[model samples]
Target chain A: MTDATASLGSAKTSADALFQRKRLTAFAVPAVIIAYLAYIAIAFDVVGLAQRASGENAVILASDSWSYKTHVTRDNRRGGTTYAIEGERKGAYEDGTRPAWVSGDEDSELVIDLEDGHVVRFLPDNAVAYDVPGFGTIEAQLVDGSLNTNLSDPVPDWINLSDQRMTVTTDAGRLTMTRTRTEVFRYFPGWELFWFTLDSPYHNRSFTEIALGDRIDPDRPNISGAMSDFWNNGMWRHKDVAWAIGETILMAFLGTFGAAMIALPLAFVAAKRFSPFGALRFGMRRIFDFVRGVDALIWTVVLARAFGPGPMTGALAILITDSGTFGKIFSEALENVDEKQIEGVASTGAKPLQRYRFGVIPQIVPILLSQILYFLESNTRSATIIGAITGGGIGLMLTQAIQTQKDWEEVAYYIVLIVVMVMAMDSFSGWLRGKLIGRKD
Target chain B: MTDATLSGPTRREVDRIQDSYMAQVRRRRMYGGLTLAIFVLLMVSGFVVADDRNAGGFWDGWRQMLDFPADVVSEAWEKRANLPGLLVRYFPALMETINIAAVSTLIGAMVGLILSLLSTRGLARWPRLITVFRRFMDILRAVPEIVIALVLIFILGGGPVPAMIAIALHTAGALGKLYSEVAENADLKPVEGLASTGANWTQRMWLGVLPQVAPNFLSYTLLRFEINIRASAILGFVGAGGLGFELRNAMAWGPGRFDEAAAIFVLLFGAIVFFDQISSRYRNKLTEGQ
Candidate 1:
């Protein structure tokens, strides 16, 4: 009875010690994590970041993504008004034409009736008047080489006035007057010139009219003309966008399959079971490690210098990087192959090549195919990033658009297309895997 | 007469079987050959098209492939004395890069843990919303980090925050899928026992489910951490603050600054290799159960 009691006491002590350690570890891990986060917060300067972030830029990006502005400007010296969409030369209204919203002629007073009772009038002598619905009419004029505006002593916060320029901001529209010109901007919903540029005859035509009505352009039929105009729209560049999307896909395809082809033989040499010589296997493995270590970003930069910026350079970079990864994976798969299959092939008096073909290749083909297909999907995304670095494909266009800072609509368009493209590729690869591998799930 | 009749019937049967076997072999060979032909055609045509669209043709650039590397290396070698100073100066940037990866991975794994629990079949908080969560993760995973980074940079200005957020978003989506797969196979006995004790969902998950899958979750998280480091470096190249940004600055200065670029390249490679080794070692241990 004394011995049993002593043994139970020892067991309880050990169990209590185990629980104590576990509780300590559980608390310690979270404490460590919290300490690290605190350090990072100071290092990253989260406080400063919050202050530095611009709400105005976010507002611009958000508004610009789905809306466009039409610029109605009167050249002070030239004495004629020109109307343009987003101030692009391609979107300029014809000399005799104007948007339905604007009234009067270029030679006379131009009245831009911004909706919601906001009106911007371009008077003679490089003068402009903006009538805000709630506030009184504010007038500005370029006298001598400076802008002079009529306002009370304390100007409203919305109107920014100076000797060189005057800007009026309101919910309905914006107006600015400088020594050289007076401009009024009217905002509108949806992308401007997305279907057709101002030069196209079918610019404002409805789809129903285009489908049923006679030819809008005398040179061609209605359907074909509209189709060509939309496809070749200079501002949106649908044709170019299509080509870029295709180039990105091509880079991924060529890189993925090319790497698989190159890696398959190298994988064999790297696999210990296949290669009897240790030196060759070791050398091959190191080569893979080196290539992988160099990484796609560095490879892209190096190759871009040699090949110049293009899709091919991006493809080659992906090929080099993925070959290393594929080689490692394939070699691992090769190492894990069932030896009995190889023995069976050898027992048939098969040659070395035949033995490999019948024995090893069959066992690893499903693994290899699935891996390659998966890489193909992922490489599409990699190709986009690599394309940005190499100056090719949709990524190049996207970066360029973003850098311009005023083309948020185009940026939004490209982003949508990229997301759609990637998701489509993902589903495609998944479907192909199901078809080829007989669906593991 | 009886022996001759049996021989004739056996010979005919044997010939028929051999003919059918030969036909099957021919069909298989034909299919294989066709696939090979299509693949070869696609490769050749793709090369030609890519060559046509490229600013410099493949053949023209092939011979000069190693020239840039040689030039950079030679320049770097001449300024090798400054390399140590450059590396020291850039060490902080390297730390920032690693920090971005580590923090993003930590936050992403936490979010992904919740997402995986919600999406996994037996562990879902709302069974009807599983598809919604899965699709949300899919969309998140589909967006390239650079796209989000660039957009964020415009609003947030050039800094590491954009890169961190972009990488975190991607990591969450990727880890969520992997974590869900592991969670799907988790033994539900502990969960049932906890449920029987009148424990709430959160309590059951924390006390029962988490311990059962922690090892696999940790291994996957480490692997994701490794991937996120590479992603953070790449995001840096596109104006996000890190070593890649410094490398870009040095490269922009041209030949005279090659040493700085070289130092950065060395640092990046070393960091990547180091993290890869460390994470892989830990991942192996976790998967192998200590």
Candidate 2:
């Protein structure tokens, strides 16, 4: 009875110790996490980041991504007013033509509509009146190399009045007057010139009208002409964008399959059962490690120098890096192949090559194909990044658009397309895997 | 011998079976041949297209490939004494890159853990919103890190912060999927037991489910950390700030700065291989019992 009591006491003590450990762990983990985060916050300079971050840039990016601004510029010195979308030359309205929102032209007083009950009138001589319904009309004149504005002493935060320049910001739009130019930007939702440019005959036509109605451009068929116009849109560069997406996918495809093709034989040599020479197998495995360790970004830089920046460079970068990965994976799969299958094939009076073909290939093909398909999906994303470095795909276009800083709408479009493209590839690869593996089984 | 001993009907049956087997073999061979032909065609055409579109043809480029590497090596050899100093100078940048990856992994893992729990059918905070969480994670995973990094850099300005945020988002989606797969297989009895004791959803999850999946979760998170390190370095090339940023600056000089580039290359390669070895070791240990 005494012995049993002692054993029970020890067991209870052990159980209590275990509970104590668990309790300590529960608190310790959170404390460690908090400490680490605190360290990171200091290392990353979270406090200074607030000051460094540009609120203006943030606001601009947020607004510009989903909206566009049509620039109505009145040349203070040149005595002419020009209207352009996003103030780009490519999106410029032809001479004597103006947006529907702008009623008149350079020849006459132009009345600009800003929607939301805001209107701006370009009067006879470099004078502008902006009517904010809530506030009074803010009048500005660009006289002899200076901007003169009529406002009270205490200017509203939304309006900046100066001798050299006058600026007004409202919900409807923005207006700025300077010695050289007076410009009003009328904000609009949706990406303009995405489907058709200013010069296209199908510019303002609805889709049903283009598809079902008479040919807008008499020279070409309606549907074909619309497609041609949309594809060749100078503002959006849809043709270029399509080619870029194609190039990105092409890079991924060529890279993944090419890597698989190159790695298969090497993997065979690297595998223990397939190869007799240990030194050679070790060498091959080391080569794979070296290649993989060097990383894709490094490989991309090296290959871009050799290939001089294109889809080829991107493909080669992915190819070289993924070859290493596939080699490792394939060799492991090869090593794991059941010896009984090969023995069975050998017992059928088959030669070594035939034995591998019948035995090893069949066993590993499912794993190999599944891995290849998985890599194909991921390589598409890698290809985009590599393409940025090597200068060949949608990544380059995206970088170019973002670098311009003002083409936020274009940037947004590319982001959407990239996300869609990646998801599509992912699904495509998944479906292919299902079909192939299902057939195999 | 038994078949020969059998009557005419049995022999005819044998012949019919042989004929059907031959037809099956013929059809399989034909399909195999067609697939091989198509693969060959695609490879040849893809190579041609890539070659044609390349700025420099393969023949010209392959010849000059060794030139760049050779030049860098020779220049670095001449400036061998500066190598250690250069490496030292760039150590902080490497540290920053690693920090970006580490911080992102930590944050991404926590969010992913939550997301995985919410998305898992048997273990969910909101069962009705499973599809919504799944789709949200899918979008997060689908968005390339560079896209987010570039856009965020535009808004937040250039730093490791943008890269960290971008990679964290991607990692959350990736780890969430893997975690949910593991979580889905976890035993529901413990959870039910905890629920019977009146444990809340979070409490039940914390006590019952997390211990079961923690090993797999840690392994995946470690693997993701390895990946994010590479990603963070690459992002730095686009001016996100890290080793890749320094490498870019070194490479931009074109000739005189080859030694700096060489030093950065060595450091980056060493760091990648080192972390890769460490994470793989730990991952193997984590998954060993399971």
Candidate 3:
């Protein structure tokens, strides 16, 4: 009876100790997690301060619509004077409409109607679009005349025109007027946070409304098109993104396949059984170690400099980077193959080549194919990074968009495309693995 | 008759027999051509397409290799002044990555223990459950860490919150798979003894199953932690802030700050080496019962 009591007491003590251990572990885990979170919060502040010290106001500026119209002229002997102004209307507009285009009091500027063929001879200066309560969307058509032409379409239902504004400038003068952007353009707000920004003197004064003066060249490129949904920001078009993505994938596919081709022989030689010689084996292994140890991005930057910026450079960068990795992985797989089969073939008077051809090749083929497929998927992401750096692929476009602080909607579009591509590749690799290896495990 | 049947041949007889044997070879050409045709088809279609698609530039790759050592050294030199501050600012966040690895690995190890026990066919009545669990794990492992981060970002909102959760989920899946493999390969003697003693399932698992694979489970968890550290860096590229955020910013900003970017790489490499040594040491100690 005493022994039974003592045993019960000891069991209870042991159970209590186990519970205590579990409790301690649970507490310790959360404590570590919370402490880490605190650290991140502090780190974020440090990053923010660093960014701000460089005169960067990282906060995204929220604006609904920004429009500018400018007159471009051919100074060279290439052509006669041509007048072109691009204006963002609050609503969808047809190809042409003649509004009383206004400009500064300079007579040398040529004016054309917003409509297809209405060319107006206006010498006056600045013209800005202002929303007239009764007129729907109206801008100063001209400085001298009230030839107001209605915008081709009304304010879109989704876009709030109250917050919209525009700016117009000609050789004569500059004009600022409020106007709304198209509904499609208003989907993204606060998109500016993604880019590095330096503080401008004009704060909160919202260059919301303006007119194109002579300095506002219609041909002047806006580097910030990626982040903004401005009328002239043509980089967000589907065609551009598609072309970029296609080039990047081509680069990745070619690079992976090329690397695999080179890597297979090197891998074969690097394998312990295949080489049997210590010197050659060690040399190949060290080479793999050195190349694979370096990140693929560094190779890309190098390749871009050596080969110049192109898809070929991107592909080469990937090839050099992937060869090292493939060499290592394939060599390890070769080392792990069943030895009895090779021994049987060798004992039967088959040469080394014959042994490899009949014995080792069959066993490792499935694994090699599987790894190739896996690397192909991984290389796709790597390709994106290379493209970003080299200014050659979809990554370039995405970076440009981010730099311009363009609409988050555009960012969303590109991210969706990349995700879909990654998923498709992943699925293909899985399917191939299943087909070749028979997913028994 | 006795000498001939016993296979002892005279020299002249042996020479005549050898000549007759070498006269005609027994060749099976029927299936030989079929296999050769198949081999050719396989090589041309697969290798040809692969070769043609990637044939644009191969031999010329050497001309493009950058002098990386010089660049890395210059970068390190430039960041020498900010080295202390950079360490202070970013080291804690890196430690956070380690913390994340620890919590996720521990929790994952526990859940894996449970799954691994159930996955074994010897102990579990429902064998199909093992298959289903394995397939589920395969799917989980199929998705990359970044995609998982993106999905979790949408579900759980942005920030490190989603990254931690995503890594944990992947850890659970990965560790569970390795754990099950260990459990499946464990010795059955102790398990059999526990079963004969009328112990319950949990008791048999604790006393019988776990002890056998404990060292293996510990080692796997450590290996996963190493992988998770790398994975966490990548998650930062998607705004799940980490060292990747800084790396991306530096790249986006251009070579003007390449030094800072190189510094991050150095820190990353250092962290990896330190963790690897610690994990291997712990694994060895656990295995050696020291």
Candidate 4:
């Protein structure tokens, strides 16, 4: 009884010690994490992040994503006023046509109500007037190769006045005047001319109208014509976007399946059961590790030098990097293959190829297929990144649009497309997995 | 006895079964062969189309593929003495890349833990809002880190913070999904016990579910850390600040700066392999228990 008590007492002490260690870690882990975070905050200059951040750019990106502006400009040299959406030639109003929001003809005082009690008047000879609701009317005109604005000694922060130029910014719109031209940007919500450009006869028609109405254009059916116009929309470039998405998917498809095809044979060599020579297996494994370690980014840069920038280069880069990963994964799966299955096949008087086909392939197919499908989905995302670097797909278009700094709308559109594309790929892979291998969940 | 009745009829029935089974086997083989044919067709056509879209055709390009690597290696060899100095110079950038990954992984894992716990069916605090959280995670995961990094870079200027934030957001989504998968299988007994003891949602999750899933969660976080290192480097290439940015600049300088490019390559490769080895080792240790 005394010996039992002593042993029980020792067990209690050991258990207490274990609890003590756990207790220390419970506090220590959080402490360590907090300290590391503090260090990162200092290292990353988090305190100065606010100062470095551009509020103006943020506002511009946010506002421009959902809103567009119409530009009314009068050239001092040419002596004519023209109206265009977002100042693009493709969105330009015809010589006599204009948005209903703009009142009066070009020959007379053109009054543009920017809404919210803010208005702009485009008068003759490159002269412009802007009326901010809270502020008084500000007038500007080009005079003798220089901009002259209304009298004010101390200009508000909203109005930027210089020797040769003046700009007045307000909630509703903006007005700018220079020797070359006087322009007013009237703000409007929503993406205008999204479905049809100014040149298309179906420009202002609704979806129902296009679907059900009498043919708007005599040359073609209404729905088809609208679709053609929308697909060919200069600003949106829906066709190019569709092709980009296709190319991205193509990269993922070719890369993943090609890698699988290449890796499967190589994986056999890497696997111990399949390959008798250990050295060859080691060497194959190293090759797999090297390729994986080299990474897609390096492969992209290297392959891009030879292939030049395109979907093919991105595809090849993905192919090479993923081949290594697939090789590693495939070999591991191959190594884990049940020997009983192979023996069963061999017992049936099967040849080596038949043994592999009957015994090994069946066992590993579901696992490999699931992995391949998962990679297929992920590679789509990778293809987007590779496309950006190597210049192909929606990623390229996105990077280019972003680099311009003013195509936030296009950037937004591309972002939506990319996200949709990735989600769709995810669903496709999931569906395929379910169909081929039975439902995982 | 039944001999007279069984003999001819039994033999004919066996023959019929054999022929029908063979026919069924043939049908299965035909379906498999058709699928294989379709796959081959897709592969061949895709290759051709990709080849067509390429600026340099595959046939022409494959031969010259080694040219750039050879030049870089040769240049680095000639300037071999500078490699050590170059590695030292770029070490801090490498560290920045590593730190971005570490910080993001930590942040992501912490967020992922909460998200997974909340999203899991039995563990959810608000069951009705589960789909809301799921779709939120889906959107986060759907967005490529480069998209957020590029946009953030515009607002924040070129920096590591953007990359960190971008990667962290993606990691959260990814780890959340993975963790929830693990959590789905977690025993609810401990959770029920804690709740019976008057524990709140956070308390129950912290004390019951977290301890149960910690090992798996840690293993996944380590794996994500390795991936995030690569991601952070890629982000840098797009101007988010790290080894990739330096490498880009070196490449942009053209021809003469191949030595610097080679050093950056060496550093990136070494770091990736090292982290991969270490993370996989620990992940093995963690997962081996289960």
| TM-score to true structure, per model | 0.97, 0.97, 0.55, 0.96
What are the RMSD figures for all models against the true structure? 1.7, 1.9, 14.0, 2.0
Compared with the true structure, all predictions reach lDDT values of: 0.91, 0.92, 0.59, 0.91
In order of listing, the candidates' clash counts read: 0, 0, 39, 0
Per-model chain A TM: 0.97, 0.95, 0.58, 0.94
- Give the TM-score ranking, best first: 1, 2, 4, 3
- Residue B267's lDDT within candidate 4 is 95
Candidate 2 per-residue lDDT, tens place, B1-290, comes to 77566768887888999999999999999999999999999988998988898898978998988888898999999999999999999999999999999999999999999999999999989999999999999998999999999988987888999999999999999999989999999999999999999999999999999989889899999999989999999999998999999999999899999999999999999999999999999999999997
lDDT of 3 by residue, B1-290 (tens): 66676474575778888777765332334456676688467544543333243323334544434444466567768768876676667776666566656655666667666766667778654677988776666555544455455544443444565576677776777787788877877888998899899988888887887767878887888888876776666566556666766666766776567667676776666776678668879987877863
Q: TM-score of the B chain in model 1?
A: 0.96
- Provide chain B's TM-score, model 4: 0.96
Tens digits of per-residue lDDT for model 1, A1-441: 999999999999999999999999999999999999899889988899999999989999999999999998888877778889899898898988898999875555778899889988887777777888878888888888888778977898888888988888888888988878888888999998999998999988999999999878889999999999999999899999999999999999999999999999999999999899999999999999888888898899888888888889989999999999999999999999999999999999999999999998899999999999999999999999988889999999999999999989999999999999999999899899998777987
TM-score of chain B of each: 0.96, 0.97, 0.75, 0.96
After superposing all C-alphas onto the true structure, candidate 2 shows an RMSD in angstroms of 1.9
Choose 1 or 2, whichever is better by TM-score.
Answer: 1
lDDT tens per residue, model 4, A217-258: 999988777888899999889899998898999999999999
Model 4 residue runs over 4 Å out of place are A1-20, A105-108, A151-154, B1-6
Q: Report the candidate with higher TM-score, 1 versus 3.
A: 1
Q: Which of 2 and 3 is the better model by lDDT?
A: 2
Give DockQ: model 1: 0.80
